[model samples]
Target chain A: MKRIDLDIRDGEFISLVGPSGCGKSTLLRIISGLEQQSGGSILLDGATVDRIRPRDRDLAMVFQSYALYPHLTVAENIAVPLVMRRLNTTERSLLGTLLPSAKAKRKEIAGEVGRVCDALSISMLKDRKPASLSGGQRQRVALARAMVRKPSAFLMDEPLSNLDAKMRVQARGEIAALHRQLGSTFIYVTHDQAEAMTMSDRIAVMMGGEILQVDTPDQIYQMPLDLRVAEFIGSPKINVLQAALTEGDVLSFTFADTANNRVQAAFRPEAARLAGIANAPLAGVIHHIENLGADLFVQVMTAGGNLVVVRCDPGGIRPAIGDKVGIVMDEARLHVFGTDNRRIEGSYRLEAPL
Target chain B: MTARSFVSSALRHTALLLIAAFALLPFAVMVSTSIKPADEIFSETLRWWPQKLAVIENYTEAFSAAPLMLYLMNGVVVTAAIFFLQVLVTLPAAYALAKLHFFGRRLAFGFVLFCLLIPYQAIAVPLFILLYYVGLLDSYSALVLPFTISVFGIFLMRQFFMGVPDDLVDAARMDGMSELSIVWRVMLPAAIPALTAFGVFSIVTHWNDYFWPLVAVSSDKYFTPPLGVMAFRNAEAGNDFGPLMAAATIIVAPLLCLFLLAQRRFIEGIAFTGIK
Candidate 1:
């Protein structure tokens, strides 16, 4: 494997988004020193941490399950990292010898813990045990525990995935706010495109074992560099139509000389719209319509025998299923993937999203 | 009572009462004679109850007749030392066997399990000779050290530890805890019920132990309780009944106190760890 040339930027939140088994978790563990990479170097703060133990890695991770200690109350669980750092071996074990000064450390840890807990709105639940906590509370305490450590960087792996939808919405903001407030580097991993879109300063889209593109979430959504990434990042999923570059950027579709005849063209749902056939660039039969509360995405079977999904207002009337409808896409939003399955990265521009 | 249904519940209770009576009979006799004058024990018929209470006198004379305090102190020291050292030695061994991925962990654990099959009686001679060679023959270490690294304790703790989630260990590691601290903070704290249960088993078994201690310590000054009980046979080569029953009663009290306090933990420990 060749070396990865990543910019070791400070105070940045880098999200690694990919399907499961993409080795994203393994990569995070390697960077955290919980696992060693087979053949790559990880530099943390410009120092190699691959050989160091996880305890010395100057990093903290909140797990997917929130990994709270079952034996400990939330307060004690949150204080574990602080206690591990501040106490000597004997002082840690003896109950009373350190209990006096432990008050002082407790006050300080509690203060920091309180701030994080309050930020996460888990302050009232601090005295309860983890077993008694709801999934969201445990997730918050897990975050507070990780945050109170004040590590040089934070490594989180799908921290919000365990919560209910409402709690996930609220927790994502708190975590993003915490990253801003602390100004520390964060390496987040999730399969959630929305989480990646909303939280990260930059998202690294990984596939198989390699990073396909590392860019802003806007760049990832609007201008994906690979066919797999474009198909992966949306809800109704970006529709891929069989298309080709016939004459000097004037592309058409044949569907079966498909041999290297430009296998797929991809576009976001919002990139295409219904147009009257007299003025439409493409024609298709309306096959499916998904009406989300605020928006509707209508899927159509194109003339070339591929589905194209278009996003529109729920207020507009939709074409009946199996009804032939004309579809028009902004030419610039059209993306062609060559037979090699890589995005054709030459010049094409669409009108920007209004 | 009628003959048919009369034997149903009533006979069931009668049979249970007889079993209870059978089990309690020896204990009743021991307590009865321990408080009775010695000559009455051999009387023509068994006395259902003692005619006189001489428990105080018997107890006082029992301790005064020998170094009972010294015997108890030795027993306490040996049991406490073995229990403490057993925990100290077995905890790390158990954690390493359960969680650490060493090159020969399977082979090592199998070998540790192999130690279980070797009987103490078969190895007693070599152990005694080794203690004698090291000049630890009359010392408490001779009695305590051989039993400290308990194969059973390691095996029990390892079985309990295998249930702990690997993610929890990884979380501890990510929280900046050293592996040793993780055992103490995370593993051992969560393992208390099972440890207490094993502790009771170890204490009760070692407290009643006399064979190894008798073989290792020839000096009466280092006598443990059961060995102290054996002193009765020695003192009664002339068939002196007065002191024999008293010493036997003396040997039984500590075990009673230990069990009464730890009985709940003792029985439940095996089920708690879900291991043998």
Candidate 2:
């Protein structure tokens, strides 16, 4: 990962958001010390934990696979980290059960496990094995294991990816609520931008093995510093149209033949409006319309041969597939990216009359 | 059942019964001959039952013929020791070969596979000479030590361990389990079926082994069950088929009981490796 400079604050819910194979999971593993980085050193609470073992780092991790011990029951699985931390080797053996101290420690651990299980609302599943539980239950067990220790930080790597869609949404809310209650640092990694946006205090959008931008979710959605971040953060994807920037920094979209100073104009589907084909600046034919209960997303194939999605109110201007339309993007919301794909800073109004 | 399926099922059962009888014929003869008197053996009319019963006499003679009990004890001690040692050695080696990343792991595993190709008989003479040089000839160590590091056991267990997920190992590490603890606590519990399968193979091979014992030891005190059968044949039990077969049945009875006791686990172990 080149130039991945991220400083996660204590008690901050930070998410490393990116597409798959963008080294997000690798970065999480490196932070957890399960993987070694080639060059950079990791700092944990002001100390360099580069040479420390994963368990010694006082951090908890929730894996994508919910890597609970299949052989152990839910209670025992949750009790593992605590048992390892508290009990000595002799006290953990079978013969050690006869010792009074070991027995008391074990009972204390059972109580701790019970507390975490209750917190996750999985107290009834404490006696069951992981295989017998559902995917969501297993996820809860994994979460219970990570949360039982009350470590310095929690590192989750797509913890909800294995669940169903409905379960993922529910789990996303629970994890965010859990972060609030624990008030410990959480570094979540996910390919789903919606998850990252909903759960993170600050989302670090990564691409091609480098962190492109890091900001609050509102800023990431409103003013992304990189074009890739803008494209990746929104569902139904942001639309891009090829255009040229003329002199005096005026943004022109009508003429198609001008090739000098080419810039890609991008906007979210909600930021653009669909109007009549006669008076709007950019004319196109309605390619497809998606009705999602309260909103209609109209995919218009512009005359310059670019497809743009414009969100429409379901109660207003219902257009069929073959109808001609025009896309009038909000001038202030249009992000202009230069040829290098970096966000260009400007406030150029549209040349066409509104 | 349909008539077609009934006929096919009948044909299948008949074929299976024929094969079963063919396999069980030697055991049936040994049992039947064990209870027969000398006159019935030479009667030439192939009688499974004798005109006069000699069960008590044959059993007594079988017991009194040679030091059979001592040989059976030796078999137990040696086979148990070998199996225990093989498990102790093979598990860690298999876990390392299957899970750990290090230099020459592939080369080490290749050596194990290469050793699996070499038959025990091929190295017997050299092993015998080495035992003699170490002054462990005619000793229990000679019997148990040579078979301790079973390459076949290592190969079987390594194949089984390879199917175990790397995430499980990483989780164990994150849970603060040392590598050795992970082997014993995690890999060992997960490898039960493979261990049972290896146990059956190791016990059967070592318990009935005759060739190695014959070449390595000259003392009667170190004779295994098969050696006892040989000694019983040579020591005043010549031409006495009744007591000989009785002794043979006695020698083989323990293994039969063991196989029966572990029948379910043995089958489960043989049909292994779906641990997901």
Candidate 3:
């Protein structure tokens, strides 16, 4: 968590995207005040809340485990935050109903719980416990509980990681819609890049303990500032080729220079295509082919012993195994990195065939 | 069912029935002796059914011989007070030992486990001396206060509370519950099975305790059921077998009824705590 400087805007959906153990969840916990950060201070709306307790911080969190009280029914679970806030100690006790004020407040809390349940379409599950509900239903109940509080911000840690694939997709849309309707600041933490890319206004790609880059999903995919960010964000990973900038300012894929002008050239599978072996800058042998009914991905072993995946059309001419083919990358889509792994912003053109 | 499984099942049932009857033989003898006339109890041949029934006389004589009802009431008061105070003390202590992170937490839990090793009788003399010095001897406080801090209850509850998830605690904290409220509102409800198990252990141990009562108090008015039975034997029902057996049966009847009512929860609690 060194030098973590993120300024999330109001009503913005920002995602902390990283692999496991990358300190994303830790950062979220620190923001929610569930955990303390030893070296940094957290400010909410220009006010420092480092010493504030989680209850007073006024931020709601949806844990990955759902964290619903098993003994409480769905409605009671949803009403917990409100009940704790609105009722005094005596009013929250067993004999609270005897007090006129408490009874009226309890009715108000019940109405809030009912409204939250209705908004989440979980009104029918109000009386049922979390144990009896399906994974998707319990997730909604957890959402309902967090939403019922109407906090200033929502901190969710992999909220949909427990659902089945189909439910995860459905829940993804529901959460996105919820963010739009509520228009509150949402800080989501997840390891799945697809979740971050699809749902977030700005995705913060994290690795090790630091945030590598923060940008919109489209910009993050097309123009990553860090080499690792580009490699981590896309499925069927981007390919990195060992290349050297020779004397004539030519990019040679097979030649490794003894001088310090060495660089790593990277490109996505869709940015490169197959060409005649004599005409392209790089050549490779087709290693394997994956046919997914609508798309074909061809894995090629380059002459420099690097495996690069190329996305090909299923209706195009399918290349056979062990055939040598030329690799022609979309020059504009190529991401060039310097020796220090920072993206080099320049136009790299192939002047002559390798 | 297959013949082999049937044979095996029959053999198992037969073995269980033998052990059950063996365990129940003393109780059956006590009940049979309580209902029989004195001369029939002394007969050479063992007979379950009494030739002359002395049920009414034995029961009336047992009730008249000593204040059995007062003894039962004393038993109820002492055991209930001890159990209630124990739960009041045990819940917070166990919650801290199981969940809270503090200085000397491990050391405190170690002390609890150490205390479980020392039986009550070993410390009974010091407890009696302490009660005497405090001028609480021969009173209900003497009976109840000595057994209030049950180390076994703490250990049992701590073990149960350890199984509860930390996420649930965090959730409660996020919901604005104070730590004490979380104990009663969340952990306590989830720990009912363990509480029931500890309750059975505490109540039965205290209700049937004889040595503690004998040493702690001297007044016949403060006598528990076990002490009352002893007093009844030496004072009024000397060598009166039928009345004595009747008194013994009456003293144990309440506990038996209670055990029957809580049998299911007791078993569930035992299994939940991983203690047979």
Candidate 4:
């Protein structure tokens, strides 16, 4: 990763969000000590842990594949870390079952496993193998296995990517609740921005092996530092119109070789509204409409030959396809970007006669 | 079923039975020869059943005339030793070759494949000379030592281990298991079918092995079953076919019982190896 640096706070639920092959999963693996970073060292709680093995790192990981031992029952799989750490070789053997100390340890491990299973609501499925369980249930078992140890942190690599859409929404809430209850450090990696936006305390937007921006979900959506971050974090992506900035902070936009007109610029779809055709400054033909129950998004082919999506209220008059309509740019909500795609400050009033 | 299907089924069964009879014809001859009286054996007429049964005399003489029992015991000891030692050596080697990345890993695997191409018979003379120089000749060491490092066993196990997912090993490592523990506790259990297949191959090869034991051993105490059966063909027992057949039956019985018991698993294991 090219000079990527990140600081994960204690007891914080930080998400690493990016597209595929953006080094988000690789970063998580490096943190878990599963893969070593060639150039940098990782410090856990002020200790350099780069030399430590994964087993000794005192961190638990939930894999995308669930990675449960197929031969073992759910309870046994959950008890594996405890068995490895608390019991010696002889104590884990068949003969050791007869020893009093080993018996006590085994009983303690069993109780811990039961408690973790109860937490995940998978108590009744303790005797079943992973293959027999459904995908969601197997995911719970993987979570139980990771939770039974109560390690320093939990590193999850797209743990819910294998679940169905409905299950993913439910699992998102459950994981957020889990983080709240455990209050442990969680470094979750995912390619889904919605998952990161909804579940993380802070989302780190990664791209091209670098973290573009790190902020809360609201801040990331509202004030993206990079153009890529702004486009990636929202659905029906933020529209960009090619414009040239003239003197006196006046924005000049031209549509299809038409004469340039001065206007206040806005990027977000929600900031544009339909206005009366007589006095409205911008006009576009309605190309398509998407009705998502409460909100209707209208896609318009602007006179500039650019497609722009405008979020319209469901209760308002819906524009028909191929209808020529005027657009009123919300002056206060407009985000002006310079030629470099960086947000430009000192916005002026809308120059259209409304 | 329908009439036509029934007729086809009958034809299939008839074909299978014909093959079974052809396979069992030699065993029938061995049994009939062991039981027939000496005069009946010389008679021109072919007798399917023995006119007189010499079952008791033949079996008793088969055991008493030569140390047939001793030879059978030696065969058991040598084969068992070879199998156990081969597994003990091959499992780790295969696991390393399949999973671990180290210096010379590709070169080492290449050497294993190269060794597989060179038949053991081609190296037998050099092996025998080495054992002779080490003074291990005529002992069980000479019988068991040469077969210990089975290239086929290593190759089979490596192929089997390759099928095991890397996630399992990573999980085991994250569970605080050492490399050795992963080999035995994780990979070994998962490779049981392949191990069973290799076990059958190794045992059958070593148990019926006449040439190796013939070259390595000369003493009566260390003679394996096939060598003992050959001993029954001495000049003194010139036409004594009864005891020879009895000894042959005893020598072949254990392997046949083993194959019958584990035939399905053996076939599955061999089939898995062939696909890889």
Instruction: Name the TM-score of candidate 4.
Output: 0.89
For model 3 the local lDDT of residue A188 reads 98
- The lDDT values for all models are 0.81, 0.89, 0.91, 0.87
Q: Could you list the CA RMSD of all candidates, in the order they appear?
A: 5.2, 2.3, 2.0, 3.5
In terms of lDDT, which candidate is stronger, 2 or 4?
A: 2
Interface DockQ per candidate: 0.62, 0.69, 0.76, 0.57
List candidate 4 stretches off by more than 4 Å: A248-266, A275-283, A303-305, A326-354, B1-57, B270-276
Worst 10 residues of 3 chain B by lDDT: B235-244
Off by over 4 Å in 2: A255-258, B1-10, B49-51, B273-276
Which DockQ value does candidate 4 get?
0.57
Candidate 3 residue A204 Cα shift, in angstroms, is 1.8
Residue pairs with backbone atoms closer than 3 Å in model 4 (clashes): none
lDDT of 2 at B119: 91
1 against 2, candidate with superior TM-score: 2
What iRMS does model 1 reach? 1.1
TM-score of 3: 0.95
- TM-score, each model? 0.84, 0.95, 0.95, 0.89
lDDT of 3 by residue, B166-201 (tens): 878888889898889989988898899899889989
lDDT of 2 by residue, A208-298 (tens): 9999999999999999888899999998899987777877576778645845878888899999898876667687898998999988999
Per-residue C-alpha lDDT of model 1 across residues B1-276, encoded as one tens digit per residue: 678788797889999999999998887777777777666768788786767666777777678777888888998999999999998888889999998898999999998899978878899999999988999998888889899889989989998889878778899998777878788888888778778888887988888897888898888888888898678467733454545577777777787887788778766777877765
The pairs that clash in candidate 3 are none
